[model samples]
Target: MRADARKNREHLLAVAGAAIGEQGVDVSLRDIARRADVGLATLLRHFPTREALLDALLRTSFDGMAVRAAGLEASGEPGEALVSWLRDCVVWTTEYRGVTVLMAAAIEDPGSALHASCVTLRAAGARLLVRAQAAGVARGDIDGADLFALVAALAWLGDQPSLAPRADRLFGVVASAILTGAGGGDVEGAPPSGRG
Candidate 1:
């Protein structure tokens, strides 16, 4: 890309990220363009569709989480690795209010721009769950889909004004339910403060 074109794309991404963080997945593209001080046509040229823009926004986060999960998987006991990664996933998902809904939909739609990244993220979580299950530390009944759903469900709680305060506790409850012998907040490699 040309220097000026790359600059425009970066600026648009920054503006769109802030807008989506505040207004969620449904934020208007026109508003994003306005915030970036560009015409909507320029925005469209950069991101042909809303899903394309969202894909650009969320792909890095999805990849980062996958890398984090890999690090957690290699750093500790299986159960702790799974639980710690789960906590991080839920917290990250909660940061973007409505992205989980799109993630869920994208997971089932191969043609969607975000589908590949979402699938990779889910696979990363699934690997952690599989490792834990193999170690007999996590329940055998639940699979990767269940684990991913738990993340979406927990994140949805964070989006709710009424239930937001309880999200952290609820995450603990869910995380504990997944593990055979570990407390969610007390996982071996988890942060001491236990934000989730």
Candidate 2:
């Protein structure tokens, strides 16, 4: 694209990101254009569809997670790296309300604009899980899809006003379930004791 057009696209994405952060994924496209001080037609010309716009806005974050996965793989222990990345994914999903629904759909629809990025992020998480499992830290019974689902489920807990307070504790329970030999003699759904 031309330099000015590229800059304009970047500006639109920035505005869209802020708008979505404030109002969520279902925020009006027209409102995004207005926030960017551009005509709706201009925004449409650049992004054409809501999914396309969301794909553009979220692509960088997805890609960044992949890079983070690589860094963790190189420097962190398998189980710790996997858990850390999973925690980050859950936190990020909660940041954009209603995004877990979109991501869940996009992962299943190969034709969607967000599909490729979602797949890439899942693959990154899968790699981490496999590493952990190989080290006998994480449960081998689960796979990448399971880990992805856990991220969505954990994010959902954070999204609910009533459940948000317990989200952190539930996360530990889920993590313990995923990680083998994590905490001993633990009750299911009980928060891990701060021992050993």
Candidate 3:
């Protein structure tokens, strides 16, 4: 593709990504083309089908998460990095609510790009989970599959804006309790104050 054509394609992907990632898979490509200031033909040339476009959008999000996870694995302490990764996952799910639905659909329908992304995500998440377990900072029995399910549940909070922030807080509280093997922050029901 020519330089200008490639630029237009990239622009279209960005616009389509935000729209579909937010609105859902049902978003119209014509609107995406208009948002990107490109013609219909150019959009179709880049993504032949609506499924292909949704797959690309999901792949883009997954690829970004993979990169961030890789970076966390590289430089951060194992337990700390795992916590950071969990926090980031909640934030990402909140931003792209449609992703949870897309992931579920992909799991039922094989040969999907979203399925490939899920595989990669599982591998990456497993690595971090193993590291956290080794450090005795996470549940040893927590598998990657379970974590994926939790993330999907977390995404459901996005449907209700009033609950999203509270959900993140509750997730953090529960995750910390699981990591520390504590219950409701002791009998007094107050979180222990520390430099953790």
Candidate 4:
């Protein structure tokens, strides 16, 4: 890329990151272009679609999440590392409004630009999970896919206006169940039943 073009792309990415972080993924592309002092045509030339823009914007964040997961695993107890990482995943996924939904779709769609990044992030979580389960802290049956789904679900729930207030509590309950084996059976599906 030419120096001027690269500069424009970087500026656009920075402005878009801040706008989406504050307002959401739904923030207008025109608004982003205006904020970056670039024309709509320039923005379109740089990012042909909303998904492309978002994929570029979030790539660094996803890489950071993977790095953090590795650091957590190295420093903390296996189970605690997994739990702590999951909490961070929730925060990371919801940093931009609608990011969690985008991530979920990206993970399922092989053609999505974000799919590779999402897979790397999930693999990071899976590494911690494998360690936890081997240490006899996490449930044996659950896998990386399960952990990824749980993190995405928590992030989605955390983003909802009605559920935001209770999201922390929900995380606690779910984390406890995953860590302590208090609730028997699959952690990925339904909540455990109350004893009579």
Query: Cα deviation in Å at residue 28, candidate 4?
Result: 2.0
- Checking candidate 3 for backbone clashes, the offending pairs are none
Q: Specify the highest-lDDT model's number.
A: 1
Instruction: Please list the C-alpha lDDT of all candidates, in the order they appear.
Output: 0.85, 0.84, 0.68, 0.83
For model 1, residues 1-196, the per-residue Cα lDDT tens digits are 9999898998999999889888888999999999999899999999999999999988889999999999988889898788888888887887776999999999999999999999999999999999988888898999988898988998888888788777777777787788885423443332222122
Off by over 4 Å in 2: 182-196
Question: Could you say which candidate leads in TM-score?
Answer: 1
| Tens-digit lDDT string for candidate 4 (1-196) | 9998888888999999989977888999999999988789999999999999998899998999999998998888887788878887877777788887888889999999999999999999999999888888888888999999998888777778777776777777788778854332333422211110
lDDT of 2 by residue, 1-196 (tens): 9999999999999999888877778999999999999999999999999999999989999999899998888887787788788877888777777788999999999999999999999999999999888888888899988888898888878877788888878887788788886522232443221110
TM-score of each: 0.92, 0.90, 0.80, 0.87
Preferred candidate (lDDT higher): 1 or 4: 1
Query: What would the per-residue lDDT of candidate 3 be over residues 44-79, giving only the tens digit for each residue?
Result: 989988878777766776888888888888877676
Clashes of 1: 0
Ranking by lDDT: 1, 2, 4, 3
Candidate scoring better on TM-score of 1 and 3:
1
